[model samples]
Target: MNDHDAAGPSPSPEHHPDGVPKFDRRMLESLVCPRTQQVLIYDADAQELISRAAHLAYPIRNGIPVMLVDEAREID
Candidate 1:
């Protein structure tokens, strides 16, 4: 067998079939709200990180979470 064959198929990039980058849920394990330094809840429907303590909703753009306080929306 050739070296290429032995190496096997190349690893697929982390993305959806439609070309959109996939959000890594594993990141939530280490992620925290910038303002309150508290755990965040993932809102898949809104694509945001909800910080209950801070009353803020951080947006997720292009599959990347915007953790900056300036970028966060004030939640009711």
Candidate 2:
């Protein structure tokens, strides 16, 4: 079999080469601040997911979005 067939299923959403998470509309809408349940804004320029209410921004590294609270960076 070819490599495609051997590979079976596609890669996970967190492992894209572009360093941007492949978030569907539903998923994006569902992602709220764990602490405040506030909406998040997608910052393409910064390549991060920002929660303004929480003053937190999650980074996307090598196409993988770091969603952990501890891994997020504080924004001004």
Candidate 3:
């Protein structure tokens, strides 16, 4: 067995099969909703930054927040 095989693979940033890179969880701390001017909460399960006040979910594309209202999903 080779050293590389024994050491195994190292941890890398998580991403989707589509190649969308996952952003840092700490990024949530400074994000705000453009419409409501309110802080966002990271929804790791859905890969979105949710703005409860605006009732919208902004997508995290390639590890960056697409904060545009047009791109955001309206919540019920």
Candidate 4:
């Protein structure tokens, strides 16, 4: 079986298929904050996504990103 089949179907960010950065879709449906599993909001001004429920902010490094909890910034 292919690796994808083993992992089941998941809507991964739209990459170049050749493993290159192209576009991302996680920004649209990633609602659960990785830290606290809370709701998240996109902060276009800061170019960083915020999780008010978790009181943390995840950065969009470069162009592609996965806002995992460990990499998130704590809010004041």
lDDT of 4 by residue, 1-76 (tens): 9888999888655444455444354654855676777766766445567888888888766544557878888886
Better of 1 and 4 by lDDT: 1
* TM-score to native of every candidate shown: 0.75, 0.60, 0.71, 0.54
Query: Which digits, one per residue and each the tens of the lDDT, describe model 3 over residues 1-76?
Result: 9999999899888886878788888877777899999999998768889999999999987788899999999997
The list of candidate 4 runs beyond 4 A from truth reads: 1-26
Number of colliding residue pairs in each model: 0, 1, 0, 0
In candidate 3, position 25 carries an lDDT of 81
1-76 per-residue lDDT for model 1 (tens digits):
9999999999864875666666779999999999989999998777899999999999987789999999999998
Model 4, poorest ten-residue lDDT window? 14-23
The lDDT for every candidate, in the order shown, is 0.88, 0.73, 0.88, 0.67
Query: How close to the true structure is residue 67 of candidate 2, measured as C-alpha lDDT?
Result: 78
Ten contiguous residues with the weakest lDDT in model 1: 12-21
Give the C-alpha miss distance for residue 5 in model 4, angstroms: 29
Q: In TM-score terms, which candidate is top?
A: 1
Between which residue pairs do clashes occur in model 2?
Answer: 19-63
